[model samples]
Target chain A: MIIIAILIGCIVGALIGINAPVIPYTYSTFLAIAVVAALDSVFGGITSVLKKNFDLTIFISGFFCNSILSIALTYLGQKLNLDIYLAALVVFVGRMFTNLTIIRRYYIEKWTSKIEKDDKELQQ
Target chain B: MKIKIKKEKLVMSITIGIACFALMLVMFMQFNMVKQTDITGIETMRESELRLELSSWNEKYNELNTIYQETVGKSEEYKNERESYEKTYELLSKELEQLNKALGKTDVEGEGIVIQLTDKAGTQLSEDVKVKRITEEDLLIIVNQLFAAGAEAISINGHRVISTTSIFSIGEEFLKVNGERIVEPYVINAIGNPDYLKSTVSGKGGHVDALKELGHETSVDINKNIKIEKYEKELHTKYID
Candidate 1:
């Protein structure tokens, strides 16, 4: 699942890059990505607060990673003189790669095994 | 174990499907508006093209109109020039004939009278006391009085006075008559009704009195039976059109 997400991100980025100048909703695409990233970060924070196991390091790292990604994307736009849409899509691919490789491996494996078992039973 | 779809899932699915359908409807309306805009843009381009053509025609028409007016103005100017030239030619021809008669040898007899005016030497000067010399203005006044009295031909100090001539001072010690320089004690000779010219000069309130007031003497001599010589007038300046 993680690998599939990275592949999907790459495909989305390439497509957006190819249609760079023509995409009218490029701004909205970045907005949507930002909204989802913020929501995920907030939910994770809330869960940690409720459990009372909020290691300052873990809490800070999780938020910092996403914040760094957002800041890095903006920095890339300024440095490369890129359109905001192209920059956001490039950063999205980078985040997807990071997620599938290390961040979401445990969660994706756990969910994939369960999905496979369910599929086998349905087939049977 | 078999899983069944619940009521909440069914309601959520219906909500998502309705939202997607509404989004599609908006996209369709947007595409239709874009098409309408394209059509209107074509119409506007056609209208602009027509306006440009009309403006070109207007510019061309105005250019032609100006040309026509300038041509008419030039024609009127040429006509006035031609008419004036003809009138000047007639006047000059008459002057030439008179000059030829005056200069040409003539067995054919015609009558002319002469009047001579001489100033007394060293008279009682006027209040100005400026040597009491005769002036060009005085000669012009006497010549004009002779012509007014119907004198046909006139001369002053060997220079003939024509229809157009001016007698004036050029510098301190020199005066010009018909543009020729001369000195003082001017002798004026004119041919016409000598008796009439003599009366006109000696008449009451005449140039004779005016000259006397300016401290210069004047006289009129009539030569009726004298064998007069005719001479041609040589014009040195073009004074008239």
Candidate 2:
């Protein structure tokens, strides 16, 4: 039932998003940075869930805050004539990689333990 | 307890799903905008390929312009040649007219005056008195006066006076004009404006009055149409340029 709800929500949200009008070229850079931040947040959420410590409120707040902070930084960078977005990108991508590694390790360990238990049962 | 957990899970999954959907949508839109903004797709082209295309197009334009200039030059040359041909044709026709006039091959006609000079009537002259008649000298004077008055052509008794003409006395009653014998009364025809020719001859104390005073009967008449025959003598040039 949970999986069905998630699937329905994802499909509906995707449909709405696909039909939405594109933003102006000037704001696209901010959107790109926000997207990167959102992706990092998603990976972080997945990693936390795999570790059995996921908090819905924290995940939601992180997703929105990270995107908003990155966009604000990009605008400030334009005012200052600095490439602050590059710094933000680097940090977000690095965290995403770390989260991805954690997720990968959790899945590998779970799969290996399941296989080991099956072998022990067969030996008995 | 199981139902409560299941409800909580469902809510969390829905939220996560919505976030994921939003992320995907933003990614698609950004991708589309970037593709549209980069129209030339220059990022995909190598530097050498761009330079080669630019140089080839420039060469093509230069070749086309060269061909255009060559055609323009050829047309200009043809125009100059045609103009030169027209000028030469005009010059040749003008020379042909001058040659015809010099050769006296053209029969000419124009508005002019005719003068008749004869001896005084025999009834008015006694046998003892010397009778004055028109002579070669008198004829020469009249011809010179007519030429000074802008006569274009002159003839006396059907004989055309060209540059080679000779006037002399043939006998006491006959005169030679252009080697042709002419008798009195001598008829002189001159082609020119009749008004100016008449004024030149009949003016006060002019040549006509002078001839009348010399006991020669003279009459002047203005004729609108006067024809002069072409010189019939064969011309022989001893020397020419």
Question: Against the true structure, whose TM-score is highest?
Answer: 2
> Which regions in candidate 2 have their CA more than 4 angstroms from the true location?
A1-27, B1-14, B37-241
Per-residue lDDT tens digits of candidate 2, residues A28-53? 87889989999899899889878889
Error of 1 at B69 (Å): 63
CAPRI grade of model 1: incorrect
Q: In candidate 1, which residue ranges exceed 4 Å CA deviation? A: A1-124, B1-99, B102-131, B225-241
Clashing pairs in 2: none
> For candidate 2, what is the interface RMSD?
2.2
lDDT of 1 at B196: 81
| Residue-level lDDT tens digits of model 1 in B1-241 | 1234455444434433333333333333334434444655443554347668789999999999999999999999999999999999999998987666554322223234444444543564565455355666777888889889886666677666665567898765667876778765566666677678778876786786667666565555667543433333454556756
Give the alpha carbon lDDT tens digit for every residue of A30-102 in model 1: 3344433433443454445445654444544554465456646755664675545355555555554554454
